[model samples]
Target: MQHTVIDGVDVYWAQGPAPMIATLTFGCGVRDESFRTLGVTHLIEHLAMSTLPRLHHEHNAMVDIEVTKFFATGKPAQLVDFIAAVCEALSDLPLSRIEKEAGVLTAEGSSGCHPTAGVLLARRYGIAGPGLAPWDGPGYDRIPAEAVTAHAARFFTRGNAVLTLTGPPPEGLRLPLPEGPRVVHDPVSPLSVDGPRWLAEDVPCVGMSLRGPSVSPVDAMGLQVLSHRLTEVARKEKGLSYGVDGDRASADSASTDRFVWVDAREGQEAEVASILWDTARELATFGPTAEELEHEVAGFREMIEDPRFVDGDLDEFARSVLLGEPYLSPAQWLEALAAVTPEQVAAALTESLRTALIVVPDGVRLELSDVDGKLVELGGCAAPEWQPQGKVFKPSLLARATSAAARGARLYLAPDGVALVDGGTRHFVRFADVVGVLARNGSRTVFGRSGCVVPVDSDLFKGIEPAIAAIDAQVDAGLVFPPSVFAGD
Candidate 1:
């Protein structure tokens, strides 16, 4: 790839087929926003794109887990104009348009990743970083203008962007972005997991996520091989599933996650989940055959050698460049994949399954096994074993008299924070670590940094007004917010 610096941004390009394509990538995404500011990255993308005038060329912009990308395909001059307009809009966004654009975003109803992948990420990392994927946060319309401005200033800058093209730089191409230093974000780490477990969620498909190497072709091959094997078994033999898809996600600088998702036919969700789990176990035990490895290598080669693949290749390079991570050229990556053997692939899968988690659709019970060859049951959100001690408050007399569920619930209010005890499960939200609080209908729903939610609703418990008062007095006023007028959330 060819490289140059234009208008304080790194530009990369190479000759390829068809109308030239220009992609401008910024090193910021959903992972950078706090829970209160969730959907802000996408909000920014919408704000920038909303300013563009209608044109005949095909152009679009998107925000992912790690970066926001704007791309257009047209004549060289058209691309120059498109890119310049996007940059100018970002540098000085039309703040008046936020409310209008926010409603548009709500209608669009988009997410950073696939639904299954988003669930697994939240399971793996709680509610911070990539874990924020499945959440709507305070909602798009709820995001404050100050938060939007701060995020754009910190992330959408010239030094924090990389430009790639399917051809050489277009004459007069300029990136008129705000002058700022590159933002270095800390790598995201997984929340502490007790062990390998299978769980059921309200997902459309059955999926599995395992911790693995982020930058290993061998690991990639292992996952591809798994996908191939599932296609053969789930789709062809049993006719239980229609598709099998997965994605690679970077968990940190060194390690990453490999996910495998499969959608089952009606009345066959359990069967598909069983097939997926057994296939993974079988592969982990025996590894791939020489024929399997060769087939994957051929597929990888075919994908990399195509001229149109230059876009994907440059995307890989841009991710590494913007994030300060290692980069492997197309040729170098091909060489590494070619050298991977069956034994190495097996070992990689074996290690990854040690941290594996399988999530199936509702009503799909799974009998799974771990890497250790023992039977395992399904798991869900685990709360602390012991109840937190504090000023105890029982259910309101009216609720207790009317509802059985209310009779069993209790609230423990303490000087530091509060905990909700519902039967055997306990949810503790500490004021010192609360990330966000939702205030609506004269109640406060507290969100803790540790992924716990404690609702201090007056109707639920008697004498909870003091508890609500304590929460209001303890939590930082900045972290609390009311529902947006555009929507109730």
Candidate 2:
């Protein structure tokens, strides 16, 4: 790959087939926003694109977990105009259009990865970082104009951006982004949990997340071979699943949470989950045959040797450059992949299987034997057995008289945070770790960085005023939002 610097931004390019393309990608994305400001990045992309003049050229923008891209394909002049306009818009975003764009985003709905992918991430890391993928958060319409300005200034600068091209840099190309320091993001951290466990979530398919080293050839091939085997057995033979796919998320600079998700055929969720579990166990215990290993290697070779993959290679390099991640050239990756053996694949799976998290549709249960023939049952995000050491408020007189559930609920308010106790189980979130707090009228729902939600509302208990007041006083003001007045009390 060829590289240079333009106006303080890194520029990378490669020679490829006709119909040249260019991408302006920044390191900031969904993971960078607070829970209250979840859709802020998507909104920024829309705000920038809204500034573009209508043209015949094919151009668009998109935002994902860790990068936002503004891409276009056309003559050199058109490409030049597209990026310049994007930088200008980002530098002076139309604050007046905040309400309009916010509504458009709210109507557009979910952002980032697929819902199943988000759910899998949330299950692993909670409602922060990669886990924030699945939620619309406090609602995009609630994002403040100041927040939007601050976010764009912090991330959409020349120092933090990378420009990639399928051809050499076009003449007169310039990145006019405001000068700012590069933002170094913390590596994503998984919630501290033990062992491989299966649990039910509201997802449509059966999914599994295995924690392992980032971009490891052995782990990648292990997942690839397993995916192919599942497609063969689950789809071709049993007809229990319609699609088998996978996605990956960075857990840290050196580790990743790789996923293998299978969408089931209605009443077949249980069977699909079982097949996924059993096949992974079988492959880990016995490894793949030589024939199976060769087939995947052929696929890798086709990609590595093909000139058309130049653009793909350039994009990967751009991501690595912007995020400061370790980059592996196509040749480097191919060499590593080609050298992988069945034993290495099996060993990788064997180790990652220990920290695997599997999710099935609600009410579906998984019963399986581990590689050692031990019956292992999966668990869900059950609350830890402990009570908040704080002031306790009993149920409201009306709640006690009207409902058993409300009668047994107790609200705890501590200097550090809050919790709700119901049926001897506690749901809690500390103010110090809050990702977001949704406020409506006098009611507030606290969202913890660890994925717990504690509602300090009137319906659950009495004397809720103090709890609500405490929340407002404790959490950062910027991390709290009233979604909408029309959302009701």
Candidate 3:
């Protein structure tokens, strides 16, 4: 593959067969939009591609957290025409059908399940920048068509885009991108949460996210090997989980985030969480065995040497360049992987555990503790205090339950808000932030705009129907989302 700069846009060219693949990428996605303008980039993507003429080739577009890409694979002439058409569309986006496209995006988001990484990011970082999508609904109706056009003009420029091809250059190849300065995005600012924090979800599996340095290949490899070892022990040896895997994402120019997740059957979440912690601790403390290291290294080498690896796709290169990281060749990557030692892997794991976040299924608590002595509970800023006027429901006080810790808590309902007093700690949820009041199995849960989950202890609380109805009346008519949205499903 050869790299060059054509008309201020980076181009990567490689020689291949007749039907070639070409991808055009931009350094803008969810990370580039503010919380209020969350889905603008995605809307632009849909609109830009909506104008393409039908062709006998495979063509599609994808918008990720940090990059937006459009790709096509077919004859050289077909690919050339597709790329030209896409560029023209982006240069001057059609906003006539924007509302229709936004409805499509909203419907898609409503139907799809949120990923664990997105939930974790939203919890660690507030609904701003990269953390916008998980916490808030798509900003389709809020963002006007003029803002979409402005966003495209700023990000879809020659200076911030790249074109990569896997065949000879096509005849009459032209990109209709405008000349402009490259746009630099601000790094994501994550909230400082204590380690080993757990967010309760209604899923049956446990998910863990560990963050590490972005530019360290050795550290990345270590986490990969550790994930493999944990999966082997949890799924193969104990039959506790169905599958386990690990993935990495670019957090910033200087840092990378890695996630290790395990899925278990119902009634197995606690055990799975325990085993995951144990494996992580053991790997960080003693390092990988010789046999394990050998196998992992071999696998790594094979993957790098695979013929299909080739020069990375346009999206990968765009991410690397935009994040201010170098793209290593396969030979260079193999050398780095081979040089990684067990001690290094162990140290990497140890460092990653310092700020790990553990998410568990509902009603299942893990006995696992962090490397530190205490585990900090994650929450948002305290709600402002206000007077309680409506009927007060003391379900826990009436039940006289003594088995649970929160059994002594009190729920005070008001015309404008709800308050829960547990011992000395008081939590207030204002009507404005109360998206919905979820009632299930005689219990009530309040979801706050800050992603706080306040559940009335069902074991001790009784007759929450009145409280649910009172809270539901305060919420806006169209603002009530399904319980699954808060379940991290």
User: Over 4 Å off in model 2, which ranges?
Assistant: 371-385, 397-404, 485-489
Candidate 1 lDDT over residue span 55-166, tens digit each: 9999999998889999999999999999999999999988899889888888888888888988888878878888888887777778889999999999999999999999
How much does candidate 2 score in TM-score?
Answer: 0.94
> Tens digit of lDDT per residue, candidate 2, span 435-486?
8888876888888877788888876567788888898888888888886632
Q: Give lDDT per model, in order.
A: 0.85, 0.83, 0.70
Query: lDDT tens digits, residues 364-475, model 3?
Result: 7666665575555554333455554566656555456554655667777766777776666666777777644555565666765454446654655666677666666776
In order of appearance, the predictions have TM-scores of 0.97, 0.94, 0.78
Whole-structure CA lDDT of model 1: 0.85
Q: Which candidate should be chosen as best, given lDDT against the real structure?
A: 1
Worst 10 residues of 2 by lDDT: 375-384
